[model samples]
Target: MARPSEGAARGKPRKIVLVTGGGGGIGRAAAQALGTGGRHVVITDIDASAACETRRLVTASGGTADIVEANLEIAEETANVVEHAAAKGMLAGVVHCAAVFPQRTFARATITDFDQVMGLNFRAAFLLAKAAVPVMEVKGGALVLLTSGAVRLEGADTPFQRPFALYGASKAALDRWALGVAPELRDRGIALHTLTPGAFVETPGTRRIDRRAIPSLPIVPARQVGEAIAWLARNPRMSLAGRRLDATAFGHTWGPG
Candidate 1:
């Protein structure tokens, strides 16, 4: 398979990869990793300052990046981010990491809370895919949806406890949706897959939650998840479509040097 950067070597424009939630956490890490690997990374986040910081980090490390500030909960805004990336260069990959995890127990959660979580976490992925697939179809690419282990674990057993109910539901919905939609995208030469960190990651978002509720599982570094995403983006193959991959497993096996 031809890597994303090989185009640049062949005198073609550098391919672009879109990373949502790029202000921090796994999103920031993925942006840095992909950019360092020679892909022009387009980072979208609600926070302009934080996204700019990510852009700085990418450029400082001899990579290229652009920031598109967006509130992904809005369907139009979500699609607009993809449009912005496609305008930059060949839209080669997307890492959907934008999500909200409000620490509200199910009993105390309101319809508004549900809407907010599901809107950004689930709906944004749908909207981005709708907009990006056609642009990417001209040249095959990859779409990686970041999922959580909370989707499988019981809410009470999760690190976030009862508050994880809505978050888990949102991820479960995304996982099922991605699985159902992957086959058709694969036929279109677009590889779609869901990825998990495979363990708790102490990101800025997770830091806000109660640490006492967390279990004894090993903490996976954000960079591991980032590298796995970059790996998937660089190798968008038909054989890899529709699968659920673990970042830790990839890190141990075929990770970046």
Candidate 2:
């Protein structure tokens, strides 16, 4: 992987990174990681307070950042996010970390529940990418879609109420969407891909589960996934487009000492 310059850019300003779902867990980690990597990071979330806190964390890390409160499923908010990032000049990358994994089996899941899950997990991704594409066209940029390992390693015992079917279906659909959009984005000098960080994470998002039942899965640290994402954002590799990379593969390629 390439080593990014230590400080922000001079005249034209630093490359800007728009991270959706930046208020929590991997999103928060990725935002902070990118900020430290000399990029101007924008942290947006449905939660205003969380976004502000994340912005603080990024700034504390010696990187410039801003917080935008947005419900990504809404088109207007999505447009505003893109417009704000474009105003920054070179929107070099976007890390889409927003998702919903409500653990209800099909039998227990209502149509409303399924719609909400699909809306946030898959539909929102499509809309976010739509918003991001124009800014990325300024030169070229990277797109990173966050996915879970649960989709592939389905049998893992984590009593977090396996929304296994929903999670897996949404993920597979998201992957296909990335692949479909990659060629179009590539024509516009953009690179799009997905990253799957499969492991048990103890974030506010997952904390809703029973602690005792949280399986002792061989987990990759959240920070490692954040670092890999930061590296990938700046790396600009065409081979990554339309591909889904797991934590193990990414760790083997770019893990720290």
Candidate 3:
């Protein structure tokens, strides 16, 4: 684990925040924002090159970061990531943004596809929270699980057009699981919550989707979501635990304001 030069010399250990899928999109943005806020960010992603680029961006902004390359879909690897973050310094929070949004309708989707989406999207979160809660209990920490609007079934009657069967199922399962387990984690001084972007944001994954199929909804900047993640990490109040929070609805200023 590499320590910040200034903090190392002064014997001041910086708090660590672990970010999954830190290679690009919201993950990279969160790393940049958290790092700039003076937290030592430990970024894990399957793509070593992309994760390295995120580290460079963090460093350029005068923040410290370390990269770990691992596939979160693998149970062992997910647990190992938490262990690695704990070794760095005081582990403060975890931002889980690694997920696959494959556009597959039920008729076209196979069991293999189901496993792949659920494995990374939901199971990895379970494994991470199980591994991190113990380490965070020493003081306290936060876990922010990225959720999606696809989970709502009110207006999603036409699944064939949207093709979010697998993606929506995975996110819905994650939301229920987090809601069920959050209070228990809260008792242990660990705040667990689900967070949503509140609007569509262009990312490497979403860019693959056909634009015509997507509804004409408001688009949110990725940096705004990053700011929300940083805010949740810095302030893990019990009142906020077990809640599903929307980044845009909070009306909080971005960064140190």
Candidate 4:
């Protein structure tokens, strides 16, 4: 399969994009927006039903997308996703949005829980970058990873005093991962951007939490979070590589408000 750079031969609109965790929230939003932008988006998720539902939403909205079911927590599945996309020819973009946040206190948290969170959040970022570099190397492309505000506001002095050490630590790892990949991406004609959505969203998991316990709760809507992701995915600015965008900053730049 030819990479975008080799196939484009010149600057042109990107035609194909692959988004992990595209079945829900920001990933779905990015897929939908990119599809509306006239790109063929491939949507993959651990949840088969969610992937199908997202694909349905895209098709209904006059966008194009394909659903692929894969558990990103597994290394082999992660590699397969990239390989599958590469074989399709000229993969112009990749969005890594799949994540697992196992919130538990240090004493109560098992190594299995921590490892699972790390595996899904940080390890997947590393592996996906490795797998996609080849396809993106031939042509310049954008890479976006979803971090969390948990990392940024986890300190004791923050407004929210949640026991999210595990989640924060993993996200901090993601920050480092994005920075570590920036130079390599520069050499290979790719850009990496990290999007950090602050606070619990109205998603099913978050709705289970006490609304008051989450400070600055709903400061930014999930759809707005999705739009910020869409911007980072589509924007051609190289300066954004290795940089992290918080909810407020991204919202001010690309929100309905």
When summed lDDT is taken over every stretch of 10 residues in candidate 3, the lowest stretch is 1-10
Question: What TM-score, computed on C-alpha atoms, does each candidate reach?
Answer: 0.93, 0.88, 0.92, 0.86
Local accuracy of candidate 2 as per-residue lDDT tens digits, 129-244? 78888767777888888887766655544554364578767877888788888888888878888888867766788767554555565666777778778877764557667677
TM-score, predicted candidate 1 vs. hidden true structure:
0.93
Q: Higher-TM-score candidate among 3 and 4? A: 3
> What does candidate 4 score on TM?
0.86
Error of 1 at 11 (Å): 2.5
The 10-residue segment with the lowest total lDDT in model 1? 1-10
Report, for every candidate in turn, its global Cα lDDT versus the true structure: 0.87, 0.77, 0.86, 0.73
Q: Candidate 3, residues 1-257: lDDT per residue as tens digits? A: 33363355578756899999999999999999888878889999999999999999998988889999999988899998999999998888999999998887778899999999999999999999989988999889999999988798875766333688788889999999999999899999988989889888888877888657546868998888887887788546577899888878756532233
Best by lDDT: 1
lDDT (tens digit, per residue) of candidate 1 on 161-194: 6678888899999999999999999999899989
- Runs of candidate 1 with Cα error greater than 4 angstroms are 1-6, 153-160, 251-257
lDDT of 4 by residue, 52-73 (tens): 9888877776666777799888
